[model samples]
Target chain A: MKIERREFLKLGAAVAVGLGGGLTLDVLTKTKPAAAETRTDVAGTRVSSKALHAKRWAMVVDASKFKTEEDFRRVKEACVKAHNIPDFGPDSKHQIKWIWEEPFERTFYGVDDPYLPEAIKKENFPVMCNHCENPPCVRVCPTQATFKRPDGIVGMDYHRCIGCRFCMAACPFGARSFNFVDPRPYIKDINPDFPTRTKGVVEKCNFCMERLDQGLMPVCVEASNGALVFGDLDDPTSDVRKILDTHYAIRRKPELGTGPSVFYLVGGGGAGA
Target chain B: MLEKALSGSRRYWAWIVFLLLLILVGFLAYMRQFEIGLGVTGMSRDVSWGLYIAQFTFLVGVAASAVMVAIPYYLHDYKRFKDIVIYGEFLAVSCVVMCILFIFVDLGQPMRIMNVILHPTPHSMMFWDMCVLFGYLLLNFIIGWTSLGAERKGFPHPHWVKVLAYIAIPWAVSIHTVTAFLYSGLPARSFWLSAIMAARFLASAFAAGPALLVIFLLILRKVSSFKVGKEALQALAKIVAYAMIANVFFFLLEVFTAFYSRIPEDMAAFQYLFWGLDGKHSLVPFMWSAAVLALLGIALLVIPRTRKNEVILPFAMAAVYLAAWIDKGVNLILAGFVPNPFGQVIQYAPTATEIMIVIGVYAIGLLILTVLYKVVLGVREERA
Candidate 1:
């Protein structure tokens, strides 16, 4: 077959687009740290003056004082309800989890005895999607259904999901959940409140994109009695930064190379803080 | 008077009736799924993929095995395979059709699948997978069926058939390679995150796919009085034996490196798969059984005495099919997810509805194969 001018142009465009995508990724990787150095002023922008670290969303959970199951319920209920996660028998359909309390042994990496009632501090700390810096979910999703935002929070395109569930399979944290069945019936209120996911699709925590659009902290943060601290991680002056500076904080599965955005702080028997 | 030879054929009719009943049951089950949703199946959030995906993985290999015939006879010009070559192509046609159907049933909404074609995602491997698989199916059907149609008309085969033959060989290998990449390219799922997965997928596909084709075609040879000679059977069996050796070698390499590397994350999945972690349902039994079957099958094929024995040859082919399916179908996907990343053991089993769909998909495949076989056999026999 003879080559047409349009086909040639189309071929050129394909190559250009391919290279453009590669170039954009390269620029992003290179420009990230240097951009962090140029830290902009939040006072002049739409960001809250009080919420100094507009981008940093971090939490310091003091697991030492938690004695009973009620402590776990209070924090978990607030976190789950805030995100409007559709509850399964106990979990969720696609398991729409924002936070939870894993047993000390499950949470820690390596220790001779992870659960020492007195030494280990048997309180509950909430766990949510890490929203990794280099998320494997985004890498494996064949449909770009799952992606990491420029701001570091990961998001999923419900409509684009082919129900292949590759993202769920790829996540190290068991973070993504696939909608094996239709979710619409279980959601009676229609949650025009939150975006509804379809059956045979995958859904997970989006780090609460709807609230972010309205310029508010995540519902879980607001529900907390100073439990979760949400702010700009890039800015050092944010409340999350102050907390991180004051106490030692840890992330789940730090060795896997998925740089977690959510941090945890275990301290003096504090009430879910 | 001529009917005397064919009257005791309740077996042929019995098989058809049985498969039709299964297809009906499958259709009703599918209707229930469409009305209620995929919830009718056993799959949930944690165990996202179930039996349907497993079957798809297995059948894709079946479709790709047509390559063995194409490679040796077409590329290398082996005369013994001349008769079995057509059988391979027809098997491919039915398998690919079944493979596509299985995926369609697996989807949440079959209609929305068009979006993948309409609004393409080049970055997505699924996009390439769709294009390659669909193209391979059409290419095989047209090239195989059209030549058969020409033969039935008492005409010399078209020159275009030769060009199509050459294209089909590489095209066959690509279908499985691309399928393997669909899993291997994923940066996560340490179990499948290996570099040599694509090669392993191809090797396994060749071994199992042709062995299956031989068994299926041999049945046709016996029942229909089709002259599929011993020479064709022997050549195909030998090809399968070589492919099996490669598959086993790859498995050993994976085991050796995974155990030796001292990486817990990588080794953990394998340990769960073969040895069973701390007494939770050891897949080791299934895997070892598959290994045993494969080795026995290889021995039965490669040795001169075993190859001469008709009983051993067919038995070996069936054994080869079982080994390959267990390795790729049941174990491959489960191994990746077990002892889930949090180090918690998760249990998964196909629900009744899930099993029904699987049965339906197989019945559908057999139905297609039967029709294709009848048509091709009629044409070929008339010519003969």
Candidate 2:
């Protein structure tokens, strides 16, 4: 079992080289440090100095202000363009829309109203992920593919999603969409900035997290012409809270206790109306 | 035991060949689905899950049904089930294998399936389901093989085998209960959201599982030297009858609750399944047929003369099997997704490719069942 001096030196050299290689590998593989404390980039991506920060990001939709189909279309177009969302033609089966419109009756089905305003009923309300305070999708995801950030946005990591579609079933708003087919083929013009998903993974609105990192407002909010307001629910001075304070706001399926961040300013008496 | 399965009669080999062909076809269909995407199936964004999930749900119950035989034999020391208990365990092994396969095939990213384990999220029922289903498969395979081997060698099985059997009884219940929770825990799906969902799942499972066992037993009687006694068949039929009645009772209770409360959310899915929601009636025919067959099977099983009649029992069991398949296998999962949370009625039907793929999975299950059953019969025949 005794080792010669030459053999001992050779083994020592091998051990030293192995240790040095391992240390170098560890440093190389380490994730890049955050740009700053104020604005945290999600995936080691660059964040602009003037990036938006929120304790809990929220969106306030004044459905009453959405008067025309063009208003809805423009906002939807902006999101589609920014996100590189696929168009699965008109068929609803394989369709992958991050943000879309539903009629007033469907959007506010939980808010019972036998005698609602005809104008409100006629309008198509834009719906996306509610990003619930107690998000079921996050709770149900086996791989944490879909998770809620500190800012209260329910973010999806498409690469990690095993595409079991449990999150799709868990969402009450029908916000999530599965990539039934390869989404790359359907994208008319792919946005290189935002990542496009492959087939078999579930996807939904990320509330423009990357844009927030770049100090840009959500494309839908910027496009809506005052119909959609994006702000921090936690901040009292935020637009969402100010609007909540001034006018009564209703959330979809509030009874379910998901505590949705998205609020609808439907004018009359909110839920009672 | 392995040698017993390898060598069989012309009919057995022919059956094996048929299953292999089906499996080959199914693998090809699955490849296409893998290449193109889940779009090859009839599933949509609205009906996020289709045939694969439904079959997974159904087979979980079937796999759990092995407990029906295991319990009476192991717990109650029911001597009648002693001769047939191995058959039940083997059946479970096959069904559990199919159950795992169904879940694997249903995944959008099947390759990343290890992620379920890689990053274990205990909060997710799926992770727990993965644990329990695999655990159940292992328990059954070990118990069935060891017990059969011990019998062949003319010795009592080890005490650890009995301890495992005890663990399996509750473990069996957990596999189906967790599966029921996978649906019932979801707040969005009102149809599946009920206090009695687990109970209903157990009831249907008890009915479906034993009825299937009876059919397998009858088939064994015909094709091989394996003979499950008339008393055992009758006892199993009684269990099936009681469970089938309970299943129907649970359905009626749900109907009553939904209709009485008149909560649109609660009633919407039921309306979609039984009648048509927004003029969409794709599931109505299937649902009605399930109802009628369920009632018919219950009546036949309850009647003493019909239950005692060997010729009639198989037909009655078949009715029960088909009815449960329609209700739990096809409609339950489909109806849960109907009205799509937006209250829109979107119809879904499986494609030919999807059906072929399903057939392939069943072929795998049957192949396992056939080989396992062959070994059991071989051991018994050799003893005789």
Candidate 3:
């Protein structure tokens, strides 16, 4: 029952924290809900005259419609130009890409179809961040710098990101990219409406959160002709859900249990070879 | 205590100056990196982490090894470890300092590091890792300094010091376990998503930590009045032998699981490490070297004749240390990111700038260790 100097100090600290620290924490937490609403507004919801609202956002990519390399290039260019994603050239290891093309085998892994249709086999699939319903990236992010919004957009606060790249490691889709260098100089054309990321912060396709706030569709969807469908997944009547319902769509690495919001329509292109 | 480090032999001063010079070079490289970006390093979108995180991972093991010394002396009340436990604690202090620095340098925004604490996300293993690492540093620093000070004044350590020592034993295991969780919990990297990751990390840390302690104690015995008896060194060697065997056994278990099950994703990283996976064999040589060295270390340590030889023992310990460093540090972090999620292989070699920064962090850690050890040597010499 003897209290030594160390125990005495511990008791004092406990008392101080119980009284002063609790009061400080109370003041801090009291203002949290108001601040969180603003955070949600800044990150997800903005009350515009024509702003789009949805419980969960999702995408359906008609892989068959992307017949030529130009189809992929168009959407990529639209995203890059709109986001001010720097062009580090083809050979640069430090390239930042928002949307890019991957081979069919690489995109939807575990596919061992030997006699795929020539059209489907030759075509490159467009891949980007799935904005997962249960994002591992968000779970691993130390600072809540990346989080999931109510609308199902996996959002990133670049300023808050400490650039640990935990998100990059957590993302199974290879979606996230870190700015290895100052990205401003590499940007061919700076998008004034959108802010460019500094070196060190992790970034990926944000489903055009900024554009969505303005009642505009994602630039990729707009530039994708009929290949890309973006809408509310929570609403079954939405275009993305409708396409998902009608087609035998598959997500990237579904077995991993990330519940990818993005789906690709396969076997929808003519008959198999 | 602080003044003891200020006065040292010509050779000690020379070593200090050399570390300072390396620190200077590293500082300059870091400033350049700060102005430019991590682009100065070889990391790309494909391979995000490299040497900095690797060194951090390795040092965490070295830091956690203090528990090996603590358990025998403090928990088991073994008198043989009484003189050396302080050395183990001081070594832990320096390593934890280096671990924090490595994380600091690896940060995209070092200035914004407080954000992790400010917005606490208990769900993030990185957050837990930060908490445990810092807590371990504080624990070791207080325990080592307080106990050493009491000894310097010719009195037993206060009652609470013993309590803190017991707490530190579990704290040591937690630091490395939390670090393993940082990788193991990730869904993307098939290489790291293993249930045995924490067990493997603890096994390696136990081996590598004590092996390092043996080397440091041997060096201390040679150059100073500090001399541990042969029995203590032998006891440490036994710990290293058993732990090294456990580490290798755990790794073989992983190999068996990967190959026998024939999970392509699980096998891809092992293939990338041991043999060239799709003509990308950058890490194959390192992995093989670690395997050979680990086996050699085990052979040297397992045999009583070689383990007892003070001259040969240091070499065996060095081999153990390097193997653990390469396996846990280099291979684990780098190869885990390979064949990325897209099944693409992008080669990642640390840039010269990255290496310099790494050396700088090591120099800082070594400098701290030298100063702390100097103080220990000074206090012991007075007692003698």
Note the residue pairs that clash in candidate 3: none
lDDT of 2 by residue, A134-212 (tens): 9989989999999998889999988789999999989988999999889898898987666778889998898988777
Model 3 C-alpha lDDT versus the unseen true structure: 0.87
Q: Estimate how well candidate 1 is docked, as a DockQ score.
A: 0.32
lDDT of each: 0.70, 0.87, 0.87
Residue A158 accuracy (lDDT) in model 3? 82
Q: What are the TM values for chain B, all candidates?
A: 0.94, 0.99, 0.99
In the predicted model 2, the residue pairs found to clash are none
- Per-residue CA lDDT of model 2 for B315-354, tens digit only, reads 9999998999999999999999977778788889999989
Query: Candidate 3, after superposition: displacement of residue A245 in Å?
Result: 1.7
User: Best candidate, DockQ-wise?
Assistant: 2
lDDT of model 2 at residue B329?
95
lDDT by residue (B1-384, candidate 3, tens digit) is: 778889989989999999999999999999999999898998888889899998999899988668999999998999999989988999999999999999999988888999998899999999899889989999999999999899999999999999999999999999989999999998899899999999999999999989999998988888877887899999999999999999999999999999999988899999999997889999999999999999999999999899889899999999999999999889999999878877888889988999999999999989999999999899878887
Interface RMSD of each: 2.8, 0.8, 0.8
B253-316 per-residue lDDT for model 1 (tens digits): 8888889997776787788877778577657888889988988888888888998787788899
DockQ of 2: 0.67
lDDT (C-alpha) at residue B178 in model 2 = 92
